[model samples]
Target: MTVIDLVAQADGADPLETEPLYHAIDPDLLDSLPDADGFSRLEFSYQGYTVSVTDGTDGVEISLAETGVSVDGSSGDLIDTEFST
Candidate 1:
């Protein structure tokens, strides 16, 4: 499945005690991400609600407060957490 699809499915769940599903993707491939910049505005299903990753100058960030599943970016890291739904 595509990254978006995987993220959407994972996000649609209860936030309480939900463990963040980590998906490590190649950074090189991320450079070709189609909606990289637009992802911030796109909401995905998270904890029975729609949430979006906020794209910052450095990179993308996703946080499920209750679940403690925070996804962040790293510079030049070979393996990076792509999404947490």
Candidate 2:
């Protein structure tokens, strides 16, 4: 799952360079995410990208790890809620 998540946004050639999931999220949260609902928004950073998994967003959202940068690199916060997952 971690590799899938990393590769989903990684530069492909360097996806393996991303940090392991264990270093990105807590084990407890990671363990419970598979059962998480869309009502919940869980986010974290892997390597230099942001990873977001919302209850109903279908899948995770990954982007460059920059402040005030939206998924499209617009001038707004990509995520409104703090990291809770």
Evaluated against the true structure, the overall lDDT of model 1 is: 0.42
Q: What range of 10 consecutive residues in model 1 has the weakest lDDT sum? A: 73-82
Candidate 1 per-residue lDDT over residues 40-60, each given as its tens digit: 444444433234446666665
List candidate 1 stretches off by more than 4 Å. 1-40, 64-85
Best by TM-score: 2
lDDT of each: 0.42, 0.52
Question: What would the per-residue lDDT of candidate 2 be over residues 7-77, giving only the tens digit for each residue?
Answer: 44444555555556677677567557657664466667654456666554554433333345534556764
Model 2: number of clashes? 3
Best by lDDT: 2
Worst 10 residues of 2 by lDDT: 76-85
TM-score per candidate: 0.28, 0.47
TM-score of 2: 0.47
